[model samples]
Target: MEAVQFSPPLGYVFDPTDCELVGFYLCNKIANKPVPGIDYSIPQYDLYGSEEPWQIWNFFKQRLGEERDDQDLYFFTQLKKKTSKGSRIDCSVGTGTWQGEDGGREIVNDNMRVGTKKRFRYENKDSDQHGGWIMHEYSLDQHSDYVVCRIRKSEPALKKNKRGKCQEVDSEKKKKRSKVQEVDSEPLPLAVPPATSRTAPTTTMVQQQIQLEDETRGF
Candidate 1:
């Protein structure tokens, strides 16, 4: 029998609500305060650099060893003006550009507007092809120059049946147990009937039946 190989657990998930992103992360970042789990969760990066969207994706995907294609990436990026004298911000990549889809959306926390989030789509420089990549740029209301951005592939390259983290863990455990059972060569021991026993059920049998009934009720 072959030993089953188990993969490592799917690490922390970085999903945060819009309010949390603005009130906690964006605010802390602007204030130069320590943000918990920022290094592993949302790292600082040059989002508007020369690298294309796909190139950035491959780099991080390899570095992080993330198997899921549907996960979103969060980053702290500084916005740069188009020119030294111009007030417009540049959103161009190497050969692609991030075209804004909307003006801006207010991100409110505790009935107070904390920041603005705007959506962008990556488009090729010389072609009409677009929408393979998406980004949500978040900036503080007071400090709009520097912002936090969330990037994600609009459509996943690899598509599979959706499963939760708990489901994946349970599946791995079941596979390990099955492999162990197969490797064990010990013979089963036969159970002997009690002396002078009739058709009456044992206390253990009643307890197991009751437990099964309780489990069935859950469904």
Candidate 2:
């Protein structure tokens, strides 16, 4: 099978952690033969040149139950670009995150809401200074006519409670049931029947006298 190749969008901003374009390069296997320069500049290439790009795009979109639009194309292009640079990327669509100050919204603190407005920012872990901030607004809810970029939160660190313990609580009924079972398993005292006295019955004297009279009459 011919290997798949992805090309990045022109002049795309690179992000290490949250960028989507980077993911495509890592996933798709590149062809061994050099791609002609003309192919690179084209808006779309034959995923399997035998098939149309829209057809392949539609196939994926159908499987994902997503609309295949310009945003999706742009997203794929960006992914291709990111991969070319030796950065890592994911194959699946995901919630994207924008870090740093540039292309980011102003930090808003209100009674109900407080946080930086949704914006793309750059952060460098290696640098001594915190990365520069840029502000830009994005329509996360809207599907992009060009390329849709979705932001998502990264994994958060597990935090310990005040007592440095994180324990899951069981229902009260379960605790009671366990206690009952434990008590039932232990040995218990055996019950004994109470003792009772018996009395003997006496024979009637009239019956004995009658028997003696009958014997005397026979004599």
Candidate 3:
């Protein structure tokens, strides 16, 4: 069968929870059943090959552009045996390796155990130092050879708190602008006409004075 290629719309993110990854995507995939949008959302790739994590990140970054800088990536990769008959798997990628952070954890769905998930950190093979790249590996309890992986860069807590503060500041500025706009939109009070001159003669009075002056001239 031909493998399905996934090409998401701009700004689209593939972020499935652990239960969804195992109970839904993985189960249907291993059973040869058709998953509605999996063919377009998640693609099979050689994640353990020579490509580093950043290279994978850059590929999506360039394809999706900066608009998707926060997007998470997912892939379907099969485990590789280290020997002809051994249980060990080779997880080396390029010049770095994925080191497990803790023991595997169980993923439950609908009050039943569905799968297991494990966290791994990418470390430089030479220095053995970890980076910001983190991955969550998910696998079915019934099937372990094939698994789904979610990878993303870890964000610093300080940066997240700073962003929250910035958002609050922006919200306050918007509120002030809205109030100014409302004031500008309101109609100004009708300008009161300057008090009419009290000494000015009325039109009827002026006409009477002209008549009296004509009568006096005639006499």
Candidate 4:
């Protein structure tokens, strides 16, 4: 199967929310059911390799046009179980490691907590200058086998900066949150969208029920 590029291809926009990632796509992958664009949208990879972030971005990024996802790159990565146990994420990838920020938070799908998506910052020995890059790691509550990471270069607001810069970032964040909430609260549909399009999340029972429905729908 041809893999989906990280960036949107011609005549299409690939914009998915936290809810859709955890509720729909991640759920299907955990259940071993077929995700329509799994092979393309999110290819399997262990991103903790030696390759630099930009280098990795180039590998999965869209080469069709000037359009690109400089801030976020999606990949289906397996969670490495430590011999010590207890969900200890093996963070070492190359010369840097991704450090989790602000503990994990729950993401609800149709009023039910489907999973927790955590935010992590990249860091290295030389300097903590890697703050420009961020990783949003999503893993189902029950299924911890594999995760989908939305890696992007996000520069935090500087303390010395004025209110304008903060406002801009806040606006973008508000729009993102609004979009995610809007998509998650909607009801499930019988028909699925096309592969080129990034589908939205729908209201459902628990993840298992949603999984069954997805299987029946062949989405």
- On the 0 to 100 scale, the lDDT of residue 104 in model 2 is 38
Model number with the top lDDT: 1
Clashing pairs in 1: none
Residues 71-177 of candidate 1 have per-residue lDDT tens digits of 88887889989899999999987588898999999998778888899999887734323557889999888998988888898663212212333577799999999
The sequence of per-residue lDDT tens digits that candidate 3 reaches over residues 130-215 is 45578889999889999988887765633554576689899999999999999999999998988776897657888999999999
lDDT of 4 at 153: 60
User: Sorted on lDDT, highest at the top, how do the candidates line up?
Assistant: 1, 3, 4, 2
Q: 161-183, model 4: which lDDT tens digit per residue?
A: 33555687899999999999999
Q: Model 1 lDDT vs. the true structure? A: 0.78
- Measured with C-alpha atoms, the lDDT of residue 210 in candidate 2 is 94
Candidate 4's C-alpha runs over 4 A off are: 1-9, 62-66, 69-71, 84-87, 127-129, 155-219
The local lDDT score (0 to 100) that residue 39 gets in candidate 1 is 67
The pairs that clash in candidate 4 are 3-40, 4-40, 48-93, 71-152
The weakest ten consecutive residues by lDDT in model 3 span 1-10
Error of 4 at 5 (Å): 8.0
Say which candidate scores most in TM-score: 1
TM values, all candidates: 0.64, 0.23, 0.63, 0.61
lDDT of 4: 0.71
TM-score of 3: 0.63
C-alpha lDDT score of every prediction, in listed order: 0.78, 0.34, 0.77, 0.71
TM-score between candidate 4 and the true structure? 0.61
